[model samples]
Target chain A: MNLQARRTGFAVAGIAIICTAYSARLVDLHVVKHEEYARLAAEKHSFRQPIQAKRGMILDRNGEILATNLPVRTIVADASHIQNPDELASLVAARLELEKEAVLEKISTGKKYIVLKRMVPDEVAVALQNELQARKLRGIYLENDSIRTYPNGAMLGHILGYLNHERNGVQGVECTMNKELAGVDGHRFIERDRTGKEIMLYRGAEAPAEHGKNVRLTIDMGLQSILESEVDAAFDKLKPETMNAVMVDPSTGEILAMVSRPAFDPNRPGDFQPSQMKNRAIIDMVEPGSTFKIVVAAGALNEGTVTPQSSIFCENGRFSYGGRTLKDHHGYGHMDVHEILVKSSNIGSAKMALMMGGEKFHEYVRRFGFGERLGIELPGEIRGLVHPPNRWDKLTITRMPMGHSIAVTPLQITMGMSVIANGGRLMAPTVVKTIEEPDGTVFRANPPRVIRDVVPKETASFIGNALVGVTQPGGTATQARVNGFEVAGKTGTAQKVSEKGGYAPGKYVVSFVGYMPAENPRFTLLVMIDDAKVDSSVNYGGIQAAPIFSRVAERAARHLDLIPTAPSVPLQTAPVVSATTPNRRL
Target chain B: MNLSFLTIRSANRIRLRPILITVAVLSVILCTALGFVSIKLSQHAVAEEIRKTERAVTRLRSENEVLLAAVTRLSSRQHLTSLVAQSKIAANYITADRVARLTPPASDEGDSATRTALNTVPSRSATR
Candidate 1:
């Protein structure tokens, strides 16, 4: 071949080799490395974001909001994007109520993510965002957040518990009904461009969050405030170590108002101790004192062991049984059942218990819902101690009848009286009224639950009439009387149990449990003052607790608008004993 | 004769090339303009709708928050009690004497005032 022909052939061969190599590289990129490249692209643009659900609100029976959420923003920073760390830090510090130096230190680190402040309210966050935009600043980002707020502060702290950092209920009804209150959270797949702006066109795969359900409690804030005010006054005036009160509607077993002193605010529970956070109405166990006498009286009436007119001979204020001397406040002769209760004759009650055997008395005690948990909706209830018949010593029968050698919660004592006030039925106490949906639909409603009938109507009325005498002129709790209403109640003065296992000297747990307008009872209220700082002689329930009961009952009657069933008489005050004088029982 | 016809056909084909190229250029220009306008119009419509939705959401949220704040302030027991303490609100308690009986008397035996007080019935609305 000639020289020109050979050169042409070489050029064609070089072109063919280049074409083959390009085809091979295209095949590898399109087939072998496709998945890895696709994943990297997605990571650069798209992210999975969690849509947070709003927690439920807690409301009172009157539709007053108790616990609610305040919308807030969590300010986050991208340190790497910050151009002027000092300026950003100062602006954030002023707007978010944070330390400037700390914010500066955090932003100076070339990290991508830093949290500047959490729970900045909506207004503050809006102001900060506007300032950043106008000044052409960068690095700060706002994410949605919320804070749990109790509008009434410490008013219902024990019942409507507070939440923790993760928005989980930590105590009280909040913890018990957490699942119903906390709604389901949703998720979404979203894409953002290089400018960190959401690309609406590329948004995909979203599920909207279901907001939490609202909880409406049976608590009436009006009644609650009344109870709290009275209890506060008592706590201040009597100077008790700890005081608690519970008020329940006997007809329905609905807890209207319950309060305990030294309460911690649920909004800021971190500052309080566990002891102060306890719902003492259901948790604290105390010897019911003379309030337990109603149980024996009801049992004797229901069991046909005693008639309302039957007279029992008293031991003249002192009776020796099982090496222990049982004594009444005063000497008495033969008195009927009503007279025995009016004067709180301890020997008479012990005799009635003796008439009914220990086993029968224990049965009556159980039937009144004592020595067992009342099963209220609030968490951490305790079944108080009631010794079984087999466990009772010879002295147990007498002591138990007089509210000794037994333990019961304040809720139990109030409910035991309810059996008498409601005309012969035991009711299961309830705090929750209804569960509501976000759209104001009631998801579930609680109705009155009747546990069982403990006695006949006639029997309850007979005992109720006797309890009415308790607040009369010659009775023990005369201070419990309201001007236009017939108050039926019992006064208990229990010697405080010592830490070493015997009765404490000069210390008493005094209480008055009662109902007003005795013909048609409205509420059964229990006011318990533990360890009042007074002379033991004047530290009786009739003196300290009954007066408070009267004050609260008077206000409650007006609030409830219950018509006067009895004629209005001249208001009379209980005989005042000077604080300096040695105390004496009625 | 065949050679002459071949020369004439070749000359006609060369003359028609510029006309065909002009038509093709015009078509390309028209198509590009129409597509650009359509896409711009669509993007503007979508952005406007998005802005409208955002404003609605913001307004509803603001109203809801305002109502909630008002309810919270008014219904709060602490606030109302404070009002009562300051005498800004009336917590009136009607005495038995103020209440007049609507029903006929049950008995005329006791003191007339006492009988009237016992017969008066409270309105249920007042209680709630």
Candidate 2:
């Protein structure tokens, strides 16, 4: 073989080895290491950032803004990028009202990122940024944030609810309508320059945020104010353990105003006890006393077992049934159904129930919306305790008719009276009127919904007339009458149930449930006071709760613009000033 | 014989180098001038558009924030109550007897217009 031929063979062998190595490297780069390299490249240049959607506003029926958001910023520091840690720390401490030493320690750590302050107002944030830019500072940054604000302070706290740190609703209407209020957040992937400014030309895969829809409630701010003022006054004066008042339009089941004492401000809910946060108007249960009489009277009349003029012997106000004796506040002879309600004769009511039987009477109780949730647009509503006839003891029938043995929420009692006020139809209560989009387009509307017709119009009218007698000169709740109007109402003075089981000693829960203009019912209102501080002898519902209802109804009637159906009766000289209804023995 | 001799002399002697050089220099100057003017015009147009858009965004944002702040202040129950208490506004309620209406002929009991008005009519403060 020649020397030139040997050299050419060696060169060809070397070239073949080099080509094989190159092909292997190409496969590794394109397949095995591709994902890792691509991820690293993306991390170096592009960033995924969230575009936050604005939380919705809450408004009243008249479009008054109840809850809103104020734009703010969160201040952050990149310790590694800070040129002069001391100067930056001092600047932040002065501007943000932070501890100087803490700020210094945070900025000196040489970390990639650190949160310096949160929820800085937009104006302050802008001012601080301007000063920093003027001084040619780096490392410090501001990110968009927001804070929830309730401008009404504590007025509608329970109804409006509050938001958590993550802007999620935690209670009340906010919790019930959270999904609609939270809206859909969007995102974008974009390349940022070295200065942390987004390069718009390199923006990738962007989506715009969908803002939360607005919620319009059925609450009337004016009526709410009136109710709050009157209830607050009563709460302050009576110093009750708990106070609850609810006002509803009988014609439509719209809740005009609702208030419960021991309320916490939603803006500062953290400062209140868990007990104070309970919306007791719909959550707490109590025996409704004589207010439950209307159900039996209406039931008997509707069932054709009795009429408005039907007579029943009262057994001289003391009756025995199921081995237990039932008594009334007064000993009476025979009384008509109208007289039974006016005198709040417990024995009369019980005898009437006995005539109607337990099963039929229980059906009426359920039909009047007791023992079940009213399905208001609120959270944590409870179906109150109502024992079915099968679960009832031998004495349950007689006792249940006079509002013992049965537990009911204040809202239920109000709605029960509304059954007569609205002419025998039971309505589903609603708090929210409409759900609106950001552009004022209505997404959903809540119109009046009739649950069922509990009785005929004639029966309701007869009951309404009897209820009016309850607030007349000789009736149980004469104090509940508003000047120049025929007020129809019932007074309830129930012995509270003891936490240790039986009836509590010397503790009473008193209430007044009523509607005005006996001919044309407008609003049905309920005021309940539990464990009032006054003497037990003066703590009857007609004495304690009726006057409060009267004041509230007067203000409410004036606010509602209801025309006087009856000639103006002379205003009584402060009905609460006198103890009209003695705490009679039962 | 003399014409041929003259033509050869002219061809060998004088060249037009100065005229060609002048034309080339003039063409280069004109092209440079045109390019500078075109670049400056584009820059001005882009800068103006950026300014206009920035101004528009700023104005809209300012208006939105102002309206928001105003509404927040006005609708506040606390503020309104304070105003009423201080007699800055008259919101005292009118009783049913104080109101006298020109009753419409043959109105029914269910007529909404005959119902009590919930809103207050402004009354002068006694102290004021």
Candidate 3:
């Protein structure tokens, strides 16, 4: 072959080899490793942007907002994109009420994402955004965020509860209904430009956020205000260690108002002690005192152990049994069941319990919804302490009759009274009325539920009539009477139980549980004051607690727009100085 | 001489036809490329507009939420109660006698002349 022809042949072969290599590489890139390279490219430019779902609002029964969300912004810094860190930091610090040095330090890190400050109000954030735009500043961005707010402050703090730093509920209905209140968050795969701005055209695979359902409570703010004001006055005037009040509709067992003194503001939960956040109504156990007399009285009547007209000798105010002598405030020769309850005679109550027998009395106590959880919507409820008949000691039967041997929650005592007020049925108490969507569509409605019937209607009516006499002129709790309404209730004056396994001397827990317009009850209220600073003479439930009940019931009646049915009675001006026979037992 | 002239002309025509076909294909390709670029630019502009609208809507929503929260705080019972106390507002619960009912209560045991007047329903024409 000629030299020119050989060179041409070599050039042609070289060109052919080059073309084949390029073709093989193209095939590998387009087919063999396509998915891997595509994924890597996507990772470089695309991100999963989380769409936060909003938490729901808590409302009162009348549609008043109790707990709600306040929209805010979280200021973030992309230090890599920052041009003038000092200027941006100064502007942010001024707008966010933060230290300029801290913000500057954060922006100088050269990190891709740095949180400069959180919880910046919307107005301030908007102002800062405008200022940034005006100055052509970059890197600093505002992200959407929110905070839980309780507009009523500490008014219904215990019932509404508060959120923690992580936005989880810590107590009360907030904890119990958290699943319904916290919504499902969504996300989308979005591509961003080199400047860290999202490319809206390249957005893909999105799921819309599902916001939380609103929780409407059964509480009426008007009634809650009345109860809180009255309880606050009692807490100040009496200077008690602790005070609690709970008002419920006896017909439906809906909690209208519940308040505890020393309450912490939910907006600032960190400032208060854990004790201040306790809902004592369902948590604190106390010896129910004479308020428990209704249990024995009702049991005796329902069990046919004693008729309403049956008379029992009071041992002339002193009765000795099981190597102990039980006493009453005043000596009485003979009294019927009605007079026994009217006087709150410890001796008379003990005699009735003896007639009913220990097992039967315990059954009645359980039937009245004691010794178990009443299944309220609030968190951290205790079942209270009630000894079975087998656990009773020699004097347990007698001592338990007058509320000395067993401990019970304030809620139990209130529900026990509701057995009579609600015509023998024990209704399960609930604070939640309904769960609704953001658009006011109800997701779930909590209807009234009856747990069981404690006694017959006739029996309940009889016991109710007897309780009415308790607030009459000669009854133990005459001060509990509301003008133009028949107040049916019982007084409890239990000596404060000591942490060292005995009664605390010179200290008492007084309470009054009552319902007004006794013929047709509207609400059942409970007022309990623990260790009032008043003199022992004026520390009885009739004096310290019943008067508060009167004030609250009167205000609640006015709010409920209940017409006056009974004849107006004269108000008691001075405390009735009557001594309740103190029962001293272990 | 005639055959020679015809052959040359035919050869010229063949060259001219290939040139025309190349020009037509190039023009079509250029037009298609321009059209694709124009469509992409339009899409980008629309996307930018959508992004701006979305940002504005988000900002407005946030502002609305802020206003709602403020309104709730101002009208809360605690705030109103404090206001009443501070300003000495005469906000008292109306007595039962002052409340006019749509339907008068069945029993008139405690009804006075003022209560009767309050309880009595107004005629529809009068109400209108």
Which candidate wins on DockQ? 3
Best by lDDT: 3
| Best prediction by TM-score | 3
lDDT of 3 by residue, B1-128 (tens): 45775675466455777788899899899889999899889989999999999999999988888899999999999999999999867687676557786766455457544445677778899999
List ranges where model 3 is wrong by over 4 Å.
A1-40, A574-586, B1-28, B95-128
User: What digit string (tens of lDDT, one per residue) describes model 3 on residues A1-586?
Assistant: 6999999999999999999999999989989989999888878879988899999999999999999899888889888888888888888888888899998988887898998778888888889989998999988788889999999999999999988888888998889999999899988889878677888889988999999999999999999999998887667666777889999899999999999987889999998889899999999999999999999998999999999789999999899999999989899989999999999999999999998899999999999999999999999999999988888899999899899988898888888888899899999998999999999999999999999999999999998998999999899988888888999999999999999988999899999999987999999999999888877877889888998899899888888878788989888875523324432110
Over the stretch A314-421, how does candidate 2's per-residue lDDT look in tens digits? 989778877878887889999999999999999889888989998999999999999999899898888899999999998988889889999999999999999999
Off by over 4 Å in 1: A1-44, A84-86, A575-586, B1-52, B55-63, B83-128
Give the clashing pairs for model 1: A537-A583, A538-A583
Candidate 1 chain A, run of 10 with poorest lDDT: A577-586
| Predicted candidate 1 versus true structure: per-residue lDDT over A1-586, tens digit per residue | 6787888888888887888788778877777888888678777778877777888989889888998877777898887678888888899998887899999988888886788888776778878988998988888887777778888988988889889888888888899889988999987877765545566666667998888999999898888998999887667656777889999999999999999877899978989888888888888889989999999998987888888888999988889999989888899989988998999999999999999989999999999999888789988888999989998888999999889999999999999999999998999999999999988899999999999899899999999999999998899998898978999999999999988989889889999999977999999999999888777778999998998899899889988877777777665675433333232210
Candidate 2 CAPRI category? incorrect
Colliding residue pairs in candidate 3 = none
Model 2 clash pairs are A559-B118, A560-B116, A560-B118, A561-B115, A561-B116, A561-B117, A562-B116, A563-B116
Q: Is 1 or 2 the stronger prediction by TM-score?
A: 2
Q: Cα-based RMSD of the predictions, in order? A: 7.7, 8.0, 6.0
Clashes of each: 2, 8, 0
> How much is A263 displaced in model 1, in angstroms?
1.5
Please provide, for model 1 over B21-68, each residue's C-alpha lDDT reduced to its tens digit, 9 standing for 90 to 100. Answer: 887888788888888888877876786588568646854674466457
